[model samples]
Structures are given as structure tokens and as C-alpha cells.
Target: LWSSIIKSKNKTYYLGYFWDKETAAQVVRIKRLELHGEFANHG
Candidate 1:
């Protein structure tokens, strides 16, 4: 199984796992409401 996590300036959050990075990124972005400036090149 695959797993992903986000270690932003605020804190570290678990974004679960998926078949692709895109899916993991999407979940990360959604959970990451503290910062919007950066998110896996989602600028």
C-alpha cells in the first residue's frame, strides 16, 4: 500500500494513500486550509 504526508510550516498532516500523487495531492490540499500559497505545485 501507498501512503502520503504533508509537512508544512504549520504542522504535519497525513493525507492517506492512493493510486496516484494527484489523488494524494488533492486530499492534502483539501485538508490544508491553514496555507494556500503552496501545495505540491498547485499554484
Candidate 2:
């Protein structure tokens, strides 16, 4: 299993777990965009 996490503005968000790495990364990316807005890092 793969898990994704995002830390923003001193907060840590748990984005759940997935069976694929890509899915995990995608979840983090979406969450980052939502949380960080224009400052989101897609790299």
C-alpha cells in the first residue's frame, strides 16, 4: 500500500492510502493544489 501526505502552513494532512504510487502522488497533488492554491508545487 501507498500513502500520501501534505504539510502546509504548519498543518499535516493525511490523504489516505492507495495500492499504486501514482494514485498516491495524484492525491497529494490535488490536495496541495486545493490547500496551497497558486503556491502549489506540482514537482
Candidate 3:
């Protein structure tokens, strides 16, 4: 469910700039992964 939400948000950014979809998606995915990793490591 949360994954879907993230994907949708990325899609919105992608729609704003066609060439940035991949980069934006990668950035978003990486940020989310980093956040999850930090929470898992400390919490």
C-alpha cells in the first residue's frame, strides 16, 4: 500500500518532466530505502 503511494508520487513528478522520471524514481526509492534502513537499525 505504501509502495503504491510512493510510486504514484514519483509518477506525478515524472509527468512534470518526462526526462526526469528515471532519476526522480531512483532518488525517491533510494531515499525511502535509506529511511527504512535507518529506522530498522536504530528502532
Candidate 4:
């Protein structure tokens, strides 16, 4: 399993665990957009 993690400011957000790396990465991207807005890095 792979863990998806995102850190913003002083808090850490856990996207979840996934069996596939692409899924994990996708989750991170989605969460980042939600949490960081225009500050999120797409790459």
C-alpha cells in the first residue's frame, strides 16, 4: 500500500492509502487544489 500525504501551513493532511501509486498521486493533487487553491503546484 502507498500513503498519500499533503502538508499545508502547520497542519498535515492525509489523503489515504492506495494500492496504486497513480491513485495516491492523484489524490494528493486533488487535495492540494482544494487546500492550496492558486498556490498549488501542478507539476
Top candidate, metric lDDT: 4
Question: What are the Cα lDDT values of the candidates?
Answer: 0.68, 0.91, 0.43, 0.92
Candidate 4: the clashing residue pairs are none
lDDT of 2 by residue, 1-43 (tens): 9999889879889989999999999999999889879998798
Query: Candidate 3 — what's its lDDT?
Result: 0.43
Q: Give each model a TM-score.
A: 0.49, 0.87, 0.40, 0.86
Model 1 clash pairs are none
Please report the TM-score between candidate 4 and the true structure: 0.86
Ranking by lDDT: 4, 2, 1, 3
Give the local distance difference test score of model 4. 0.92
- What's the ranking of the predictions by TM-score, best on top? 2, 4, 1, 3
Model 2, which residues run further than 4 Å from truth?
none
Best by TM-score: 2
lDDT string, candidate 4, 1-43, tens digits? 9999988888999878999999999999999899879999977
